[model samples]
Target: MELKQVIEILNGNVLTPSANLGRQVKGGVGADLMSDVLSSTQPEAVLLTGLCNPQVVRTAVMADITAIVLVRGKHPPAETLQLAESEGVPIISTRYGMFEACGRLFQAGLPCLERPVNGE
Candidate 1:
């Protein structure tokens, strides 16, 4: 799914104007914990989280996340927005909560690919 399609599916608004809305979403991951996001090996995945902050943007950028979906219609602070724009990370806000937004994305064929633990 493309980022544009995700916007329509989740009824979200793009907070970062410079973001590449046409980028393909290879997978999805819902986690408020940045540690969990960092642990995932999936590349170019969209992150769905309820926590709206600069750290979220930073972690997404570091994790190479394709985009961010802020649940419950939450928007981040100006610092977060600025960082996201500069980092070229797209941040989207949706009216649906984290669980529902993630489910909708999954239903739309975006899978959450978590890395195996301890070579399991």
Candidate 2:
């Protein structure tokens, strides 16, 4: 799914990186803890989180997530947005909660990533 598709699916507002709407999203992962996200998220996945902090962007960078969906209408601080912008990651906000946001993306055909081969 493209970032624009995610925005349309969640009725999300792009808080930053409006130019990144064309970027492709390969999957979605919903998590509140940055450590969990860093440990498990697949590259190019969309991160669905309610944690409104700069660390969210840092985690996204570590995980190589293409976009972030701020669930429950949560808004990150301006500094967070600035960090995301500098990192070239798009930040989107939605009124839906985490579960609903994940479900919406999943139902729209954005599947999660499978475990890596060979049990690396």
Candidate 3:
């Protein structure tokens, strides 16, 4: 789904307007643990999390995630937003919790990453 559609679905606020909202995200991965995100997320996926830190942006960059949605009405620090913008990653904030946000996206046809087969 397109990033614009995901934003609409989640009722999110665009923290970084410079991001490519037209880009398509193939799937999503909701996790607060950066390690799990790094290990599980797929290329072009949107990361849904409550972890509002610069590390989240760094992780997104390392994982090639194009967008991030901060759940549960949480907002990241200025530095985090700055880092995300510099990395060309869009940061979105949503009132929905992680589970609700994930469910909404899933219902809207945004699939989640599949678990590796026996840890690959």
Candidate No. with top lDDT: 3
Candidate 2, pairs of clashing residues: none
lDDT of 1 by residue, 55-97 (tens): 9988988899999999998989999999898989999999999
TM-scores, all candidates, are 0.94, 0.92, 0.95
Every candidate's lDDT:
0.89, 0.88, 0.91
What pairs collide in candidate 3?
none
Q: Give the number of the best model, judged by TM-score.
A: 3
Q: For candidate 3, lDDT tens digit of each residue in 22-98?
A: 99999999989999888777888999999998999999999988799999989889999999988999999999999
Q: What is the C-alpha RMSD of each candidate to the true structure, in Å?
A: 1.2, 2.2, 1.3
Against the true structure, candidate 2 reaches a TM-score of 0.92
Model 3 vs. true fold: TM: 0.95
Worst 10 residues of 1 by lDDT: 110-119
Clashes of each: 0, 0, 0
Model 2 CA lDDT for position 82: 95
Q: Write the per-residue lDDT of candidate 2 for residues 1-118, one digit (tens) a residue.
A: 8899999999999999544798998998898988778777779999998988899998888889898899999888999999999988899999999999999989999998533445
